[model samples]
Target: METGVHPARQPGCHPAHNPRGKPKRPTGRTDGPSRKIEVRALAEELGATLIRAVRRDADDELASVGTGHGPVTISWYAFALEYLDMRWPQIAAKTRNETNAALCAITQVMLRDVRGRPNDELLRRALRDWAFVLPRPEPHAAPPDVRLALRWVARTSRPLTDLMDPAVMRAVMQALRLKQDGTVAAPETQRHKRMTFVNAVRYAIEQGMLDSDPIANINWRIAKTAKRVDPRVVANPAQVRSLLCAVSYVGSYRRARGRRLVGLFAGMYYAGLRPEEAVAVTLPDCVLPAEGWGRVILHVTRTQAGKKWTDTGQLHDERGLKGRPPGETRPVPLPPGLVAIWRESIQTFGTASDGRLFFNERGGILAFSTYDTVWHEARQLGLPSDLVNTPLAARPYDLRHSALSTWLNAGVDPAEVAERAGNSVEVLMTKYAKCLYGRAAIANHRIQALLDEYD
Candidate 1:
């Protein structure tokens, strides 16, 4: 039989009496120290003892089971680092950043209530900006504040086993639903965080740390997502043409920034290329004819995820077309007008060194900010004052929206529209549903004709 006394409480461990000659209590509190300090110290000791006991029991159980593998006693922070390492080579830059962000968010609620913990803001920043980017080669040590906060998190984070508890999982879900400012997060943001967390838990299950993903058992309500495109932002054909013309007139006396981007904007309006896809259009991608309609074979997109997210530290990452497999191509048929625009652009500006059709004056990739500034200036120059301030074609992306809407409204088959827009039929029907103007009147007219024939 063993006594409940810790090793520190052994008979010869310490003097039985205090310096003031008071007898030391078995509970180990002395009357000398400040109460707050004593309480904090006691809490720290208790936390450490509890952690050690839990780990020891887990180890003992594994040994009894006769398995060679060690117990799953990793901290949440350590597991997060391991998971990111496992995933880094396979995922896209944007996805990598999102994974890091989601893990950082989860870390906030996964810590034990340790004394002397860093403030919430500091800890969050440290996790997101420093601790979670495990794959990156450290250029330098983190700042003192971030390093301190990171150390606190490493010391205080709950073990991976804690995530198996329903209550702890519930806390994580609640944290996912809120922004750093404590306001409700956007629906998309909530969805992304939940998806990342669920995937992480799934990975945990595969690693034998969890029996099942606790998130699957949780009865949580996800905010409904808004699927339809706002009609106000959809530009009509005439408006798009006017905008394209206005783009030519912008900075005409300067570096011809607007002139250089005309074909790029045309690709968005007529060929329905995403801004990223348009930026990446090379000479080999386009099938430009002198007179008739041409086609663009889009194989890659140059998406601008910040340098820290990309493996190369480049501002843009060259990835497969959005939602498409690597090396798969999407061929979008361009209208004759767009073909004319492309021909003129190629003749005037020529291609970049790497054969990309649209590039800056220095032949580098066109920055999104540069094009956005030109588009805004073109809007002010082209649109009527009232329309200029409204959401009509507010973003370069809105142009692609308008193009899809136009194709749908023109009685083009939904399947064809979806293929051209590089979207699923379901997404085309759901997102661009409201933007398909004049469809209601056409449906009403057809109904009226049928009713008249019956009469």
Candidate 2:
């Protein structure tokens, strides 16, 4: 007559075979002491229990799998575990042991019961947050932040269930929703976050834990507030000349470094090479005649990190290139003087052990800090302090801008200029349109002369 005592607890009922709507176990009679399976082995044999739609334990039904480390049910939304079960070998083979370990750790964190309901909404959110902030996998594979986050959860949360509270989710959302310290996050960052969360939410829905994806509802337009950068900081011919003269007259203490700096600046300013591309230049990249001018070809670029993200945005090592595909090559041409400079670097830096033309004292790519410091010192000695601070001729990259503007001003065809500098004619004309005055005057004068002849 509808007794409240759990049927399994009724007298004379076999705990293993209780039939009053209790969870079904594997169909086997209990063997004697030596025949009972170990807990872990039973779990393996009972993996089919995962497909059950009803609560198998009271703790789960009551949401009592709290922070004290009691056994908890596995979550339905454990994408990391499912992903690992299916893709562990693939992930391991593609990256390193540390990465594989991180994946495993995260899987454990996500798969642990939350809400005692065998759901992994929180884990999905964590994965989404991580994938959002990480840089695109280039120069190297993904950093260890996912692994770090998993470890953080393990250490910080009491039982994994504690992490599943609605309040916890609210806190997480609040922390992540922060704007970039008054400045907007870069568009790339914003886009990545949205995509990461979107994918994670999609995974959750696919795993049957969610009816729909929450990430799908959030507006992503807030990221658009970040300003677009103008790429036309290149110098004019007069400014280039002044910059060159400034670079040429380094103090005796900095003479050797200055020469190297001049070569780099000239390569970028005169040849329109990105700073990294300039460092990758080699003797073979340069083509010079005994009597006349020739071209320089830039095959690669070297990148550095750390110092660059500092408030100063300076750098200190050679990490990788931009534009070029991994192991595939890209090239740019140079004028006679730049050709000569590459030749001199070849004789001096002696090429990387790998035949790279520029390197640190240890034969690595030159440090951005070393070059930046040298550039500042060069400025102090060569240009007025007022000029040094002004953007008119500040920063190494401005040389590339100057180079492009000079080409536009010197009557070079827009198509030719764009092709040489790896830009579209439309883009060049739009951003640097105001900086093309000198070349426009030349074109105007030549056109006037032609008109005079017609008259």
Using TM-score as the measure, the top candidate is 1
The CA lDDT of each predicted structure is 0.84, 0.53
Tell me the spans in candidate 1 whose CA falls farther than 4 Å from its real position: 1-69
Taking the tens digit of each residue's C-alpha lDDT, what string does model 2 give over 1-455? Answer: 87789876767565455567575556775556646556667887677676342323321332222322225433422333343333323321212222332332333334333433222444444443342112212312424544434333433333223334555434333333343243444555444444433444465456544555454344335445423224344545666666666665664544465655667777788788777677766666556565446675554555554431222334533323444344544445567666676666666646677666666566666776776776677666666666666666467776777788777777889999987887777877876877867766887999999999979
Q: Relative to the unseen true structure, what is the C-alpha lDDT of residue 160 in candidate 2, on a scale of 0 to 100?
A: 27
**Cα deviation of 431 in candidate 1 (Å)?**
2.2
How much does each candidate deviate from the true structure in C-alpha RMSD?
10.2, 14.2
Task: Tell me the tens digit of each residue's lDDT in model 1 across 4-90.
Answer: 988878765555624565555678555755878878999999999998886555434322322112664777876787777778788
**Which candidate number maximizes lDDT?**
1
Off by over 4 Å in 2: 1-152, 155-213, 223-232, 248-255, 305-329, 347-350, 438-455
